[model samples]
Target: MGRRRRRKPKWVPERAIVGELDRRGRAVVAAGEDGRPREAHVDGALPGESIEYLRCDREGPVDAARTLEVLEPAPDRVAARCPHYGVCGGCSLMHMDPDAQVAFKQATLLADFASHGVEPERVLPALRGPTWRYRRRARLGAKLVPGKGKVVVGFREKDRRFIADLSTCEILAGPAQGPLADDPGRLISALSELIGSLSIAARTPQIEVSAGDRELALVLRVLDPPSAEDLDRLRAFAAQYELRIFLQPKGLDTVAPLETGRELLHYGLPDFEVELGFRPTDFVQINAPLNRAMIARVVELLELEADHRVLDLFCGLGNFSLALARRAAQVVGVEGDAALVERAQANAAANAMTNLSFEQRDLYKEPGAFEWPGGPFDRVLLDPPRSGAAGIVEHFEAIAAPRVVYVACSPETLARDAATLCSRHGYRLAAAGVMDMFPHTAHVESIALFER
Candidate 1:
């Protein structure tokens, strides 16, 4: 028996009168014909542009296609900075100007609110930060291609799972920015080359990257153990580049340093006179400067007083809790991960703050299994993951806090929760706005305030 040949889907080239940008930042068009209009999302286009695209994918209600050419360009479109702009899935909206990018995201957030009949009284000015070289955390895919006889390392190609063959990246927060430091050597090329030359390149599937205030680290996800010679090569590479290397043979918890006695990864919050630490594999914001700005804005919306007690939900390693403790009288930080809870406890002790505490419990579990924290809390803050705090938000009445602030990564979830808070609960949606946390991508990070 022989393997059957795979048949390629036949694509029909069609020109679309593209309309507004959808939630994912792709241009939408009316594709249906039976007295109904179904949105056909076309990439590589802006609003009002006529684009030639090949329609080949059907994603539920919407058809997906990649743009072949823009028959007419939109006024807001701009030249992309990186050469790998369209191919690299790491960024979308690079063709649109920064202002336009933020505006599109803002519209997306507001429109989501409008759909739910929950409008913010005021749209806070979108929180903007440095657009390029701002990503402090990333995971680059590594794959060994036998035909090319090389390991391709970078972000996955758009609409595909394979890694893009990248020589340089404009958005990676690599080292060497001072007057005399070399530019070309500090970015993606050197890292890609180093990984390519390794003996265990095939077994290494991905590399996790993290940057603190003063240090950067890399953790390689290796499926198999490396040989003694492979260790030597990795060590030489690390020493030459002033890099910290770790290897994970299995789970994230299994990550171990290639070199011992190294510094623990950490970042500082100078605004609150606090410094926090974490493992390289831990979750942190992709943008550092924006995270700081966001925290300030959050504190403002929270309106914390010296006598007020704050409840921080989904608090990972006290990122916001420690800062909140600086202003509020008492703070309780709750997390699902026991390790992160321990880290949060250690951070509170190190900061010499006795006003904050962290407790570990799975927040998504069925109700009544876990006791909701009974509170005379004056303020509440929720920063749940994309599966926005449904099980938790419905229970906020138990806390009966006068104010609530939500930091969200998904606008859809945020809007849904906003409606819940307003309709079922007595809170009002006061204000909401987007943040450029992952600039150039359609990933929306936003904040909202609710008052009773």
Candidate 2:
């Protein structure tokens, strides 16, 4: 007899059933197409290999098991370098392609508007900067382990309470890079020779590296006062790096120099020839390039003219006021912090700007008697903190500037405030778009132009 040919096994179409059986007695569990009980399958069976997913529909929640396919990665899928990408909460979308991530953010804004019965005619393409290693500010948690006899500083892990063992964070800017990245554990161990104990703090824990046009400043937020030996090591590190070191002990009030002979720590805005000096604990935007871009965008939105007067709300150290003074007839900056107001005034003087003024006001609180700079003000620029300008929206409405440009860091607050301004104040959202200020993180920085 001729040799019998064997038939080739057919390829399964993802939902194919492996087998079926009948039970004469006893309870029989619903079987999946892979011949395994639906609950017993792992990875939910290979892709294309049967796995029925039963849905409650038509028959009203039947017990019969149905085969379903496994979920696959999205089309824009790309590999991320961080070991803690999915598990670590720090960078939520690092796995996504950077370009796609920007597009997704833009799409989200469009979706938000479409739902609100408004469509923007133009959206400036996302103002993108270096996507990776661009963070100039970070607050790191400092934990001391007795076994290790040192401090561990970095961002915490997503799933676990403990910090991730990261040596170099790709998300931090180059100036913010630490020796720890080469060998984090070993580096912390070495630092023990100088420091005593550590505890939780802000985003970038040990050395807060604020960027500038010329020099860099490293502000160290020490939970406890540094020991003599520690100070010496730090001084040596400063000398080695040729960096200015500021010690922050308790709070913003406690930030000062260790041994002063050198110049004060300040970052420069060369475009406006303005220098801003801030303590490490003070709030400053993390991304420098984008910050410059944002400030420029705010100025451009103001549509400044030689004779126009402008108001800058929550003006921190005259960032916008000075920029406005360059073009407008006069600029008034109002801030809640008296110290910041003083600093703003000093900054104006430092830059030799005459048309800028600063005032201290608790804009968030209902003041019994308050003063507003006399104005038929041509335009108003507001950059309030995350809480939004809820307390002063009426005053803003009262002023009734023909144009208002708002720079916001929170979308929900911005949306609420924008809605109020539009419905109550009669200003329309003329243009708005997200800025990639804090990339790889969920933080959204946006700007909007409102016109009557």
User: Top model by TM-score, which number?
Assistant: 1
At residue 291, give the lDDT of candidate 2: 77
**Model 2 off-target regions past 4 Å?**
1-71, 83-88, 111-121, 147-150, 174-207, 261-263, 367-370
Residues 121-201, candidate 1: write the lDDT tens digits. Answer: 999999999888888888888888888877778898886767888877777774433311244214466666776787787
Against the hidden reference, what TM-scores do the models get? 0.94, 0.75
Q: Write the per-residue lDDT of candidate 2 for residues 351-419, one digit (tens) a residue.
A: 788898888889878732456776668898888888878767755655788989888876556766777
Model 1 steric clash pairs:
none
What is each predicted model's overall lDDT from 0 to 1? 0.85, 0.62
Model 1 segments beyond 4 Å from truth?
1-9, 32-39, 175-186, 367-374
Shift of residue 397 alpha carbon in model 2, Å: 2.7
